[model samples]
Target: MNAERVERIRAALEDAFAPCAVQVADESHRHVGHAGARDGRGHFAVEIVSAAFAGMAPLARHRAVYAALGTLMQTDIHALAIRALTPEEAHAAASRG
Candidate 1:
């Protein structure tokens, strides 16, 4: 997985969502030898907390993330796993932890 590409994803998300917290993980190592990995695109997981996600449904949240990613989805990224949440949800999760 390319560190530069991962950083690009994080940057894009931050610009789009103004997230309070964001994490981007490259999971391509786990998919080594898979057909998608062979093509050079990467698998990534993203977790973001932002006020922008407030009141959005789960699917809508995911779509918003995908939109934020824009053309990266067609080029650098082969697959994505997203965990999007509002600030309040993030706070609650932290409290639970």
Candidate 2:
């Protein structure tokens, strides 16, 4: 279930953004026994770099990603940590790291 959720998120973001880099981390373990995780729902952290996010506000980018996920939010996923960026922004963040 966890792997499937991750793959779904990866595919959705990959198709919508055409990201240069995309990573989806399962964070459900961190919230085990919590309200959402108790039912086997997925908690995820996603980092995506794509030109589709260029000039978009942070909230807008997040909204776009959430929109791409469609009904998954209600049925499978409970939490999402999004780091959406353009290629240049991703590069700059990488250099800082």
Q: Rate the local accuracy (lDDT) of all candidates.
A: 0.94, 0.91
Tens digit of lDDT per residue, candidate 2, span 4-92?
A: 88998899888888999999999998997898787667889999999999999999999999999898888879999999999999899
Query: What does candidate 1's lDDT look like per residue over 8-86, in tens digits?
Result: 9999999999999999999999999998888889999999999999889999999999999999999899999999999
Give the Cα error of residue 3 in candidate 1, in Å: 0.5
Backbone clash total for model 2 is: 0
C-alpha lDDT of residue 37 in model 2:
80
Segments in model 2 whose C-alpha atoms lie over 4 Å from true places:
none
Q: Using Cα atoms with residue i matched to residue i, what is each candidate's TM-score against the true structure?
A: 0.95, 0.94
Q: Best TM-score goes to which candidate? A: 1
